[model samples]
Target chain A: MSDIQTDLQAPLQTPAQPSEDSGLILPRRSFLRGAGTLTLSAAAVAMLAGCESAAAGTSASAADISILNTALGAELEAIAAYQVGAESGLLQKPVLDLAVQFQGHHKEHADVLAKTVRSLGGKPVDAKKAYDFPVDKLKSQNDVLGFAAGLEKGAVSAYLGAVPLFKNRDLAKAAASILGDEAMHWAVLRNALGQNPVPVAFVS
Target chain B: MSMRPIAADAIGGGPRKGAVHRAGAALRRLYALPLAAAVMVLVIPAEAAAAPDPARGQQIYDRCLACHAVENNRVGPRHCGLAGRQAGGLPGFDYSDAMRAAGFTWNRQTLDRFLADPLGVVPGTTMTYDGIKDDQERRDLVAYLLSLKPCAPR
Candidate 1:
């Protein structure tokens, strides 16, 4: 907890410059290994793989459901990002703990949304064991920071988008609450990557 | 001779004794009535003095309502009927742990200072809105916010 707190409070350090051949930055196998503890069933993975097909057939109502699906998607992505960071053994204990805590938070959020969708007579979206991040092939702390920053940015946007869409006040408030935490996560990641923690205004 | 003496004593004592007892009771009642009246008069003013002006509080809330709505989560916490409420009592908004632990109630004086500079009063509050500078404005906003009763019967 102290380590997490320190990671949260510590000033942003500058990220090292990206190495040449950044295209090969994150390799597929290494990226999967970095994302921790994914146990998606084969059927679930197949379902997710059919998203483009499912999306093509979706109606307006399905679009609404898709918002939740998108949130779940972002969570899956974050879980993968955190697992990669945690498994790499590159981050200090404190940074790794913070990453792990956020991973748990994302998992909790994903679980709640999944239950909500199921209760609403919809199938929950499947989780992903691996994701495509460009920085997996890079060997430096800077590259990892870049990946985390991008992941946090996407999560923040997803939460913000979902907040207004929730009809239930309790759910809206809950989303807002989570949004604040996601915002903090974004700040911490940006700072870690040597960017401004508190931008003049919210970024996106 | 004994019966004759007892009868004479009872008849002579009755009217005179009853008048004296009645007069004493009347005087005691008069004293008690005034004492009770005095206590009531003293307590009423104190009660009125303690009750905040909900109207004025509404005016003070204008400064806050810009960034916050009564029920909506915006840049800051909701200010609807905040008088005498505990800090971090609202659900779902992730307040700083310092704010959660801070046991301050939102009475007039505390609110006034807080509205003036939230970070100064409660460090690490995410509210970036600068505090209201005018003392009278703060008072009015407080009055307005207090007017909004949270537990009003539906």
Candidate 2:
């Protein structure tokens, strides 16, 4: 499942600046970094009806759970990103509706990923109190749209990179499904900004 | 249930060296894709270009299953009866004003354009999805949608 492992690990070249509270630098690189470091093998989950789990507290491999959590983390970041844009009051009416709707989608993604992690006997990752979004850079609606669009594109790439690495085919399939959604988000945001919605025939 | 903090520092700093290295290799691979696709296009069998395959469209439809279903709606309208049905015509399905007023019927041509660019076709529609970009994918997806027979009312 390392087919897109390298691709997923490719960090976007954004101006790196540390968040005041977390002291972590590179907002764009933060979420995208998780999928790149996964070295886990894809071992299938073996579930038993109602028994105490064996190794790792459950039938699912730690690696699979880790992958889901990593994806979950990215989804959380997306929700936060949209929240920043939505609350900025920069977007007008129609764009605001679109952001809210897209944020809802991310929330759905986060909820499903969290439930899946729990189903696998793994603790889901929590969203950070604040993410290292470039608030200073988001001065206008266009800027906010561009910022959100970048995150969506990164999400698409991250999921694209992750889909092949999942040990569970179902998880991979789920990730691909979300990947499509992210791609659509990217295209829509780009369209909103008056850019080519479908710039490339094939998504990278 | 208890939750753990994301290792922000670990993600932003430490492993990035290796990630940056891998990214270089990945970029090279990405750059080569066009050439590979070109070769693939040249070698694609003629039959491969035959009428859109509903089977393949069905696979592509997996992406849409998150928001839609053949029999019922989730985030979007129920897809059954999509073919030749009025745009936003489903009863009781709350559609965006843009969609409700789209005033068009779903057919091969209309579906193709809409699938290619939903917002472009109906700006302010709350679908919030980027239409399918690939021409063949849109056609196949339209084929799959058309193949679906209208399901019974819920």
Q: Please give, as one word, the docking class of candidate 2.
A: incorrect
Give a tens-digit lDDT track for model 2, residues A1-204: 132223334442233233524533223233223323322112211121111123234344665566567667667877877887888767766678778878877777777777777767878878766555556566667778887776677567456544554456666666666777677777667656656566677853
Model 2 ranges off by over 4 Å? A1-60, B1-154
| Candidate 2 clashes between residue pairs 3 or more apart in a chain or in different chains | none
Computed on alpha carbons, the lDDT of every model, listed in order, comes to: 0.48, 0.57
Per TM-score, the best of the predicted structures is: 2
TM-score for all models, in order of appearance: 0.39, 0.44
- Name the candidate that leads on DockQ: 2
Candidate 2 on B21-60: residue-level lDDT in tens? 4434323433354477668888885345558888988867
DockQ of every candidate: 0.01, 0.01
Candidate 1's TM-score reads 0.39
- Please state the Cα-based DockQ of model 1 relative to the true two-chain complex: 0.01
The 10-residue segment with the lowest total lDDT in model 2 chain B:
B1-10
Q: Could you tell me the interface RMSD of model 1? A: 37.8
